[model samples]
Target: MCRLFALTSKDPVSPMEAIKALDVMKEGHDGSGVGLLLRDLGGPFEEMKDAPILSGIFSEEGIRKLDLFMMDQGFMTKYKMSIKVPKQTLEGTPKRGLYLLRAYEYPDSWNVDTLDEKELATRLMMTRLKIREMGEEKKDMIVFSFWPDTIMLKELGDPMQIARHLGLDRKDLKARTIMAQGRQNTNYAINLYACHPFFIKGYSTMTNGENTAFIPIRDFLSSRDFPGYMGYQSDSEVFAHILHYTMSGLDLGLDAYKHVITPLQDRDIENHPDATFLKHLKKSCRQLIIDGPNCVIGTLPDNTLFMAQDRKKLRPGVVGGRPGMFAFSSEVCGLDAVIPDRDKSKDIQPMHLDTAIVGPDRQEVKICRQTEPLTLPL
Candidate 1:
């Protein structure tokens, strides 16, 4: 099994805090790889929130190609943060040429002030896909995310060791929200694209268990003709895509997400006040049903953090923290390591029918249980 930890705060916090929590639950994951996604960025990035930042690894040739491509597309570099890797490679880590997080100004042809949000997202996603395709043959560049106010980093090695080597402890790399995963490498090759905390557009998610229904779900998603849903390097990547599809594509409310992925039995559905809608959703999204033991933790475009369990609730997860800060971790010890001053009594371990959500306000946790009447949050 893998381990998942996510933290959201009113103020910017170092990603190292989340990494330290993963260390506290070291036994749960093998030292195969680590993935981190930071949103609501702070420091220098705070001022450039409107700029689209591209986070990835690139070779010398890849950087040259990227520069040419961006210039052709009329995108100008606004700010760049290039990490300095030591000459001596750290043990168990791959030798990477350049680790970069560069923000860019909008292309000259596009008027950002007049463009629709969806159109803007499509343009950004298409640009990222084009760049990824350009580097696929030689493996020269590996792009994780191209979004505003977000940065993604992934590498092969121990979480702490990788963090130190990448200079993640720097004060400038802080964010108000962070999601991390310590991969176990149970199945699939140890490829960087297979890392958790996958992102597309503004949705991001990390899982702690296998996705038994990956093939069917993958085929269904790919059939939708959405370019952003093409990559299935890891089984858990579908969780993020499914979220984007449900919310953005279908225009469904957040509460409908858990119901769509894990619908209730016929008997239970009949008792629900929204049974008609639930039945229609179950029938239409039957292929999207997720099987196997898993716990999904993710953040929405609004920066709302949430954790949901599978029907069997085989995996472990807990959410706890005081006002202005909240953490969703695979184990309680992970939370203790980060927010020791939190009220332990209020810690929530969502069951099979529950989804624990902490809104963008960072005020309190709201438990949305399947048994209760579906009420969409405002």
Candidate 2:
């Protein structure tokens, strides 16, 4: 997360002053924005456009750094000057655009510094109130913002599952926001639909709030205290369903979110069965064994390559999970490799093999190979 900032006071400060205060503290934040929500003292609420920070730093003595990133990191830039630039020319023609239209038009532009007393009194106040109302209603407002990473988006999937587990459809769940770390080397920050109004990382004032009900996959599937997942190989949706069931069955808080890592461990199922919502995740393991032996593999619809395949040998094996991990393979070799139990019933036999690791999202990697009906260690 780049930074976090928030304020609640009877009398508001100038946007310029607010920007200067936050800039001084911003660690390495490349960009910043502000969300203005105004409540008319028990009357209708509204919000204004998110303001951006200019390409300068502020300190006790004034702007400490200048053009560090060399980008117009401020709310009003060459294009957004109308909102933050202030109006010297006035009258019927008006020196600037209407506050509401202007705020929404340049939703991405935010610079707290350029705003003056006149702008704040006439424009900023009313603008903030409208923006706040929208934020409260939709709950998807990007108050102050920054980009996100893949992990954060995947993490969101967990909360959606949790909502479904509790019988809440995608539409029924309350509003929430998530943070995504950028992929390339850029200042990272969380994106949110905020209501409570808090600071980003530390200094950036944000409109988006932490509203998601889901937990990270690692945390969600960490234990066997809940019913785990089971599904056809190569089907992420099915895996999600089983996970939802496990969390719901165990009564692990209806609104709670859970997460599971890729490539589940055998011990996750062999042990800790009593600790999870779904104790008998392996009951469906036989399907992998029954379908395995030899097969050809292909990519998913998106064809983005999300996993690495490891096929040591074509072996007759069983497949299960750490409760939340699902098998994904052309035949079932991948499943056998992960969960090999050759005791109770082993009707299927392996002859050749092909392996590929896929998902978490959209990617795949192939590794190793095999030949002949092989026996695997349980």
Candidate 3:
């Protein structure tokens, strides 16, 4: 099994806090790998908010090839940050090429004003696919997350050890939101793509349990003809893609996620207060449902956060925080590690029927409890 931790703050906080929380639950994961995703970034990235940040690791040769590809695409790097994570700093970690975070402007003809969010997002995904395929061919370069407001870093080692290696232990690489997973390899080879906190466009997710429904969900997503939906090295990646599909493709509301993944029984829906729409929603998206023992913590476009547990609630999870901030984690101890001083009286371990949503607005935490039209803020 793996462990998951996510921290959403009204202000910038380091990824170290979330990684350290994973350390608190060290026994729960084997720690063969670690995946970190930071969005709603602060620090230097905040200044480059309009630029798309391309994040990946590349060997010297791969970097040379990558530069050529970017130039061919008519993209120009406005600024680049080369992260030199020395091998010596990571005692037991596997060595790889330097990790890079570079911001780029759109192709010469395609100005930012003319390209909408989806267009730029599509371009980033296609570029990422090129990088991923290149890496697959020779095994040196792998691109992780590429969107307007996020950066992803993944590695094979203990979370603490990886953080120490990157010197994140001593620095605050700030982001308003951050997620880290202590990955326990279950199905595929220990490939980097198999790590949690998977992203496509602006949506991202990290899971703490197995996805028994992966095959059907993957098939459904791939059928969408969206390039980003094609890759599924990790079953949990579907969780992120599905969220994107629900939000961008179907134009469904946030509550649609719970409905699609763990829809209510027809009988319950028939009796639901909003039966007309509830019935239509379940019938329309039945193919996207998930069967599990899985719990997922994720974010949508606007720094909106959510946590969902399967109908069985097989994996543990909790949501708690004070005003203007919140945490949705696989365990409560993680919340304690991050928001120890927050009001404990409001802590919630949502039942299987609940979907804990933190925002379209970040002022309060909202829980959609079992199809009741009412939403109560915690």
List lDDT for all candidates, in order.
0.92, 0.23, 0.82
TM-score of each: 0.98, 0.20, 0.94
lDDT of 1 by residue, 44-65 (tens): 9999999999999999999999
Task: By lDDT, rank the candidates, best first.
Answer: 1, 3, 2
Instruction: List model 2 lDDT by residue over 1-378, tens digit each.
Output: 222221122232222222232344334233322222221111011122232222111121221122221133332222211122133432212122212111122233533256563343334333333333434443322122121100011111122221222232222111111111101112222222211122121111111111122222223333334322211111121223222332333333111111121112355433432324222333322122112111221122111111122132332222222222322222233334333442224222222232332332322222322221111111
RMSD (CA, Å), each prediction? 1.1, 23.4, 2.6
CA error at residue 115 for candidate 3, angstroms? 2.4
Candidates ranked by TM-score = 1, 3, 2
Off by over 4 Å in 1: 375-378
Question: Which candidate would rank higher by lDDT, 2 or 3?
Answer: 3
What's the lDDT for candidate 2?
0.23
> On a 0 to 100 scale, what is the lDDT of residue 249 in model 3?
86
Candidate 3 regions off by >4 Å?
89-92, 170-172, 373-378
Q: Is candidate 2 or candidate 3 better by TM-score?
A: 3
Q: What local lDDT does model 2 show for residue 209?
A: 12
